[model samples]
Target: MGLAGALATPAHGDTKAPAVVNDARLEAAYVIMGDGFATVRIVTGAAGCPALTIDAKAQPMIVRAPHASLPLRPTASTIANSKPSVFPITVCEASLPPGAKRASVDGRPLPMPRPVIRRIVVIGDTGCRLKASENAYQACNDPEAYPFAIVAAHAAAWHPDLVIHVGDYLYRENPCAPGHAGCAGSPWGYGWDSWKADFFTPGAALLAAAPWTVTRGNHESCERAGQGWWRLLDPRAMQPRHDCNDAADDVTGNYSAPYRVSLGQGAQVVVMDLSHAGKKNIAADDPRYDEFVSTHDALARYARNATFTFATDHYPILGVTIPDGEPDKPPKAGNKAFQSTFGQVDKGLVPAGVDVLLAGHVHLWEHVDYSGNTPSQFIAGFSGTQEDAVPLPSRLPVDTSPLPGVTIRQFDAWTDGFGYMTMERTGARSWKVTVRHADGSLLRRCRIRGNHTYCEPIFG
Candidate 1:
């Protein structure tokens, strides 16, 4: 299909055609990696892998660099457990030619990286749940109920410079049974079809808008959907270990390394991976804990060079909603460990320069300001999926008795629907953050100056 035909073009009013289709030739959508160099990836379905070719000079121009016909090579391992088990992916890597305008992939135009980035769309936990048992909230199958494609179109309309997806791409854990709400008889499994329906098809428009920095979520674990994550989205060169049960040995690429990307205008974004961080108490002797500390310390040092720095991971260090059945207790061990290591500047776990820490895992939206001691935490986990409906108290006490003397002066939480945040760089040291609902309604607006943030509601 052509670029325009391949993209999920939304219809008028509240209805939309199913964005994802069963294209046997091209299964999952292509991903434009935001690495230091230019890269693109595509996965083939059970029709058997075809000779992939890229004509950089084709029409509907996508990239701004000159190039020739570049053939994509299949990386190490292919997605396992696929029904046909012949699903393979191909990647195309090439250095952009100076002053180049655009390029094409299989005759479809692909988006190129921006020379200067001013706005970014942040989304996470975006996956459609298929199993009826998993849909306790009855969110599956219904387009209005699970509006990932609608959300993607809305985000694409904004035309952000790039997108930062904080992980959890594939979520078709099991097949949908007959007579489900929105996903009746939907094909379910760890295959290209599921990946397309869950991510690529719904997110096709947004994917074509700009390059992306894809994070590693627990759902992308090797045992579950790790094969898809490793094949289509991951930007790292070296392949991760394929052993489903071995967690300690599955550390490579985005899993253990911290990627630093320059966003121009004296700003930078640091992407970290804590998917392997254990849930139990992480003792001082734990090598993973040590690695986490060391990684942040280095990132803290890296943040000092940029005027504004934001870090993102799949998990959150500070959360507004408590776990189910534990309403009156403190945060979990992993959360506490994260706070102990990255929330306290006096403890040298986090540095003073890092401005904000963006995370997604709890399936809710919250903004936790720590009085400038640690990075301000913003949880945008409600991008998609069934959200946690935990209620919150009207007021939270500000406790400054802890180390570094930090306290939560203000807190904002939302569980109404799926949404994403847009960060616009207003000045070298200032940014305006607007939190909007999935249907494009304003929720709140905040301004960030130095390490401080002030927000106010936008009432109709």
Candidate 2:
């Protein structure tokens, strides 16, 4: 009923620190690790308390009752309880301040003020259902058709508080090879079973292990027109959607629910949508263009005070290749335009708050840093897709002339060049984003800042 408190130690494995909790009988203290996924343990008198339910906001939390409360039962109180034990519990996921100490509930030593930790993982563009052979993409109908399980399992191995999935949740443009009768259906049609069978059921381990924040990509618009997206992926659907045309100036929208996802010490995640960028094939002059304009304005408004705002979208503003004469592309109207329109959106909207822009859609792995603009961009798509099997090298865009502060990191290896990203908050306003290969090798990394040049690797 009050502020749930925490007792943390400045250094790892410091037992001398006393527990800092108000009511030792009802409340417990935990020191969550800032490096990896942290675990908390709760115990009580006369036999490990069996009626306690310990849960963490970011990292998944479980309440263990000494295994003695056989059939550990939860009562009406447990059912009614929702808020984190106290009024305002301090969460730590970064680093421990020097000489930090607080009085425990029972005269023990603890981190005086609050308890928090660091380390958050950000990855996406996975959930593919195809096997590559003969340089062609074909569907594989087996026990484990999708590779989501493996990716999630690996994600668990690392243990991150937050998992940000940019887009491409469902594949609508999966162009099966000419003679491949595997994926026989409309280019994009998703049944509930199709999604669960592909991503949910198979990747249950990863999904259940952590909290996920997702966005709608172009593919979601393809099959059934964002039906599956609205049903499954969009968790914040009921909030409100924004008028995309006015986004560059406004901050909130009817479809866009502006919520502060905290990572301790004033660190926050500003989640937004790019679904209002008109339908997939709408003409440039269509009224939907106003939607794109609106969304851009809104993003700038929201980035005002965010320490490191990571913008979520289905499509990418900056791309890997320069449009060598194909002048007709999304990048033309996006940040790719030389006018620094994206630069303007980055500066005017996010300004000193926004840090990174993460997105998907192209179905390829790309990381760009538009530091020259405002907050840098990291286009991490290619979350492992069936399309990778087909040789669409021609369809892939090429950027002959590169941007000044941008970086290109791509992975075309095992299983259609599959993999995800690991975003670790190394500092208060700084983060280290590492592009991991499917095999767990570091492809590239970048140091993003709130108001500094986005430093990254230049991929060839």
Error of 2 at 176 (Å): 7.7
lDDT of 2 by residue, 1-460 (tens): 1111122322233334232333344323333222112223222222222121222112222222111111111111222211111111121111223334322223322222222325555555554443222243435332233345566677656776656677665442233456655554423224333454455544555554444556665445422224344333443211222211122322333234333345566665555555444323444565444455555665566666545566667555544432333535422213333123334334333345566666665555654444344445566665545434222232234442134443333312122455667877777777776666554566666665664433344342
For TM-score, the strongest prediction is 1
For model 2, the local distance difference test gives: 0.43
Worst 10 residues of 1 by lDDT: 59-68
Task: Tell me the lDDT of model 2 at 191.
Answer: 38
lDDT of 1 by residue, 267-375 (tens): 8888887766634446666566666877777787778788888888887755555655687754321265565555443363457688887888778777776665556
lDDT of 1: 0.62
lDDT values, one for every candidate: 0.62, 0.43
The C-alpha RMSD in Å for every predicted model, in order, reads 9.6, 13.9
| Residue pairs with clashing backbones, model 1 | 63-102, 63-103, 64-100, 64-101, 141-182, 141-183, 142-182
